[model samples]
Target: MKIYFANGLFALADRMFNEVVVDKIRKMDSNIEVYLPQENGDINDKMNYADSIKIAQEDNKELLSSDLIVAILDGDTMDDGVASEIGLAYGKEIPIIGVYTDLRQHGVENPEKLKAVGSIGENPFAYINNYTIGLIKMNGIVVNNIDSMLAEIRKYL
Candidate 1:
């Protein structure tokens, strides 16, 4: 299946998605194609407006064809572009598997009291954005690690 590997470009998540998860996915199944946004060098904040539009179109095409999305929601909150991709995938009825393991970055309204309020089961994303996490849980499963993500894929797919 084609997996859209979405994540924030500003952080290490993009690199990890490519360097680590890509190889793992390949080993699991050589035929599983991964649509990595970072691999497309055209999409950049340094580019001109027209160029940015062009790149957005390119990314849109990738999302359109992806069979599923494995998003790394591992920053302060879900990256805006990644969130847009997830929304598109959801509208298309494409399955999204969100892998977010960070425990101390939950974006709670009341830092102390609501830190664990939005958690579902052991996924105490104590610092993750509530709406973002909720959206992920609504459309897909939130995995804490690569192993759990792989297991979920094996079972679901």
Candidate 2:
């Protein structure tokens, strides 16, 4: 399977996390081929310079050819590039497995947490853009952790 691993790659933490996740995914199956954007330093390396068109074109080419997209959706907001990629994948009928591991998304069943929603500035939940999430749900699914993401991918396999 060809997998496009999409996430924010600008920060050191983000880059390291991407590498670790991709490595785990690769270990899952020898036949899985993952296209990690960070690996394409020509376009992603901050020290180097690549034009916007070059970056978009290169990523689009890989995205179009991919069998699945593994999108990281854990952030204050979804990365703009990752959201755009999700849109394109949706339009092209590619399945996506979104990993959203925000701790704020937990404790939904806690009554105190639920009551907090009635108070101003006391909401205990994190919000992800419904439209972007809708696009994913229409063609795929959103998972809360890496294990769930991998399990979903296994279904595709």
TM-score of each: 0.75, 0.97
How accurate locally is residue 68 in candidate 2, as Cα lDDT from 0 to 100?
99
30: Cα error in model 1, Å: 1.3
What CA root-mean-square deviation does each model show from the true structure?
Answer: 5.8, 0.8
The whole-model C-alpha lDDT of candidate 2 against the native structure comes to 0.94
Output the TM-score of candidate 1.
0.75
Q: Residues 54-76, candidate 2: write the lDDT tens digits.
A: 99999999999999999999899
Candidate 2, residue 130: how far the Cα is off, in Å = 0.5
Model 2 per-residue lDDT at 47: 92
Maximum-lDDT candidate: 2
Reference-based lDDT, each prediction:
0.73, 0.94
Displacement of residue 44 (Cα, Å) in model 2 is 1.2
Off by over 4 Å in 1: 44-50, 105-125
Reference-based lDDT, residue 56, model 2: 96
